[model samples]
Target: MTSPGMSITQLLPDGKLIVLCGRADDASAWQDLLGPARCLAIALDDAPHEARPRTLRGASDHLAWQHHAIGGLDGSGWLAEPADAFDPDHTATLVLPDPLDPPDAGNRRRFGFRRPAWRLFEDKTMVDTLWDAAGVPRAPSIVGDGTADLSVLGAIVDQGTGVVCSCQPRGAGPSAGGDGIWWWREGPPPTTIPTAGPGTWRVRLMPLLEGVPVRLHGLALTTRIIPFPPMELVTLPRPGQGTFLCAGAVPLLDDAADLVTHTERIGVGLRERLGYRGGFSVDGILTPSGFQPTDFNARLTSAMEAAPSDRRVLLHAVNLLAREGNEPDTGAVEQLAEDLFTIGTSCTIFGAATHADDRASRTTSVRWDGDRLVPAPSGAADGRLLITPSPRGWLLTATLATARLPGGGRVGPRAPEIFRVSDEVLGTNFGHLVPPFDTRPSACLPKVALNPEPATR
Candidate 1:
């Protein structure tokens, strides 16, 4: 069992720690948290030109890079040998895999990693069954082949707004972020549908629930489950492109009792059925009636970053301990949740993929002038906008002075405007976008009672 004040190093086995990160910023954060002398931080992507302390760049992908990092592969072809900074035999080495990737057998033997069986929960087409098992309310959905007539399948679940089609993974891999999802209006479907490969692919279709996109995060402990406040998903739509951009996340406008209930139920189901541990998030739409879940991610998500700065690292450590079959101090985990609710300060992080290879970091002071964000003199801005080149593309992040706008509401509505400013000032090439429309009961589309209890204001 682990205590509240235990440092991350103490929880790990006595050895030299090696942290493999998918992004450079993650490596830098871990390095700062654990210090360079204690751990060797290696980034999978090429190190940014301005990265501090000079992190080593390994293979572009996680599995291959990790194999070489831990002496699994010898120097051959493009795959380089393990770094000589630390001797694995002389100093017992423990490698921390990237949270996003599933660990292989070699790493699992050395440290605690999430079980592969649990990763099946990430399949979009398979989650509806889990929701049914958990008794959580969800939108109606149908799973069929990709080549099937979408218009026919959509009509079954379409409630006027339209239907959302999600392509399931063709192989053992999980779907990429927001790439496999498409929203179609009430019209003729597209000729060329997205598929994992040439062979048969599975697709799940459901009515697009119109409303604010929000997610509830939960930590499933050994004894109980703790749910955090809802967060705005800030997903923007590109109509013609038939896809949505997952901008980032921020604190929600208000909290609902139903959301908490849904999260708790989902967490309990995960723990009892799948033996899930650590953090998980449920994505759904906050419609007029109640919370309607659409997706489930059985891993630590971006929402956990909104916790208090000091507790963020510790929260991650607690998750790792729980995954390792060790019980964490339940009181401390509950305290972290309470502190987050008490603080109520928004942790807004928005990003746009530029698809450019330029390696540079730029920060601009900006203020909301009417509806748009414009450049402001240094020290006289309401927020700071930052753009940096990443492995995937250029990343845009905004830190606002306040959680909500002056009028006060969810941050999702302002995502389009922020993307516009980024395109104008930084040339991010986001083109055009729009926020999700509020879902209301209509004659054509009746109200959906997603939860047993009505939503509380």
Candidate 2:
């Protein structure tokens, strides 16, 4: 009768609070969403003075962290077991990371520090089982170790279907920068995708799935070809085009609610089966029949940005936060989201040591131009977007309502097709920074590499 109780609330010892970011948690966006609570920016790694004490970016709001977490800064600081910081109770709502991992019986969930769960939400077998049980439409698939004989792959190819290379028992690539492409097996591959492997030679297979040539598809929460490192990996469709930056949830673009409902069911099934209490993401394909489950990430996926749109998901998450005693108002969260879609409000909150450097508190430019989300320029060596606010100590960022999605959404003409814009181009090339700023002695900037052109050799 009460809609399964997806939302919760909590009270922290100090006035401090922690709110899980189900959607884009960029500083510019959070400034408005959780305005009542004193804001604390959590960074996974070390940052400039203002962005210090870099906590697990969103780990404070995870379910596992509720019991043991702490908060400070007069409602600004939080130290907890992650999930509990947002919702003390496990009523609903889940936290997932990026670059998910495949599910295994040996997998165990950890909290607080950056446990493996702190990464992406990936659960391959779980997804397959759920879809198979639910009768969701999907591509044919074959699952085995990296060195299994493949009859299914060949059968699928014989039918003229291209194979989506799936690396079973997921492994790391050449490095963090490599693409993580996988797929389920099906007869013949799709024509829209370019050829894969050297000379685009598709591999043939012996019978891995009933002597039937099945095309292979894979689940990839994180890929190598990502435009920028870290936080910017989540993809956004270009304007007008309806697609997901991450995997799964593509088939129900017209009906995100239904898609989310099915997704939640799968999540519940997985949690029950695996004792999985962290981040888990499901990757599937959209076929003529319906949505097919491609794989499961026993971990987290970047798709979390979509959670804010789902009422059930948000409510459950809040309940979990409530158990931890740092209940952020559900009404406020909803109002903030509505504002973003309507009037378009933006914000940036900084957290740094009391005394830092000149670079600690200054942002080069912040402007709201014709729906185009842009950041001004800074002369710092890193030429990074994270600039120090004026008067030092505090990192400053401007939030504004724009005509288009900012930080992590679609860009360019069709701006709805999934793609990530080079921030350097937006900040420096397009000169979208906030100004009346400092152009003084520069600090050592991180050396960023350049992306090659698509046609280059």
Candidate 3:
């Protein structure tokens, strides 16, 4: 068991740490969060080739890079050059897996990675069952094989808008962020689904809940669960195109006490049922009928990744300790959650596909002018917009000056304008994207008790 006073460095294994990620910024960010320590950070992306410790570019397969890293410093292949730095007998290497990938089995040197069994919950088709067991209210959904008639299943759950079909990663690897999902209205069904691999895959059909998409993050400790504030998932749908873009996340304005309660219940259910420990998030749409969950992420989600560096680092340490069967100080964990709530600031980063291969990085001072983002002097700016390249495309990180935001309202509506500004000034290509609709809280739904008993399905 770790003491409450132990720092994040103390909780980690005593050895040379290796941080592996898909983005250069991610590698640098993780290195910063881990504090001043003896760490070797490696990024597997094409951009920012000059970063410290260097990056292994042209490696399209992030999982394969992780697998190579797990093989230790003595092995050959892509890691051989990087492996020449340290002697295997004298220097013990501890690896930090990519946030999206779980650590391989029998690797005792890996830290802060999700268990392989818990990774199963990330499949879109399997989350509804967990929601039911947790007593979290969700829209109707049905899972079927790839060849199953989606129209029939879509009719069963289709509201007025349409049904959402999310592909199941059965034999293939897990779906990338926001991939493998499509919105269908009336058509012959999707001919191609975005999955990690080819061949047949399962699908989960559910009603496309209309409202503001929000995600509630929670940390499950040994004794209890700590829920964080809700963030608006800035999802832009390309209507008739059957696809949606996950632009970024910002703090939600609506009161979400009931949603927080549901998050707590879900934490209990996950702990009791699956012995799940660490951070998890529930993605849902706040509709006219209340918050209806749509997806569950068992690993460290992007929202959590966007939190303040101090909070993120602490939570990561606590999560790693809890997952290793060690009890973290409950009171300290509660205090950390309360501190995050009191801060009430969110990290907003907009994503878009780009054709540029510059592999360069740029930061611009900007402020929100009405509904658009315009350049401003650094001292007078409301936020700083950073553009960086990733394996998929480019990422625009908007570090907002919270006090300067007018009304402190939701940032979802401004995503399209951000892309427009980027394309115009930065010479990047991000085509038209539709903004999300405002949320409508349900009047018929009753308030959820903060401390309700666990309910069975």
lDDT (tens digit, per residue) of candidate 3 on 1-457: 6534365456667767665555556566567655435666666553233321222222223344455444533443354445345424435444454363533422335666677667776788887888788667778988887646777878888877788998865665566567778886665556554433334788889988777787878778777787877677878776646777786566656567777777777788888888888878888787765677888878656665465655655665666777776755677776766665433543566664554436433666788787567877555777776776554455666677655555555566666666766666666666666676443322222343343575321
- Residue-level lDDT tens digits of model 2 in 1-457: 2232222222222333333332234432333433435433232222234533323222212221222122221233342333244434432222222331123201123111223432332333223445555444445555444333333443543334334443313332111111223222343333323333332222222221111010111111111110101111112221122111221121110223333444444444444443334334444332323334444443333323333434323333432333233445444544432322222232222222123343233333443233343444533121122433222233222222223233322112112111111233222111122210111112111222211222110
Q: lDDT for model 3, on a 0 to 1 scale?
A: 0.64
lDDT of each: 0.64, 0.29, 0.64
- How far does residue 280 in candidate 1 sit from its true spot (Å)? 1.0
Distance from true location, Cα of 154 in model 3, Å: 1.8
Each prediction's TM-score against the native? 0.82, 0.37, 0.80
Selected candidate, larger TM-score, 1 vs 2: 1
In order, how many clashes per candidate?
0, 122, 0
Q: Regarding lDDT, does 2 or 3 come out ahead?
A: 3
Q: Residue 345: error of model 3 in Å?
A: 6.5
lDDT of 1 by residue, 331-411 (tens): 777776666543254445656464432442266677877666778866667777777765445667877765435455556
Pairs that collide in candidate 1 are none
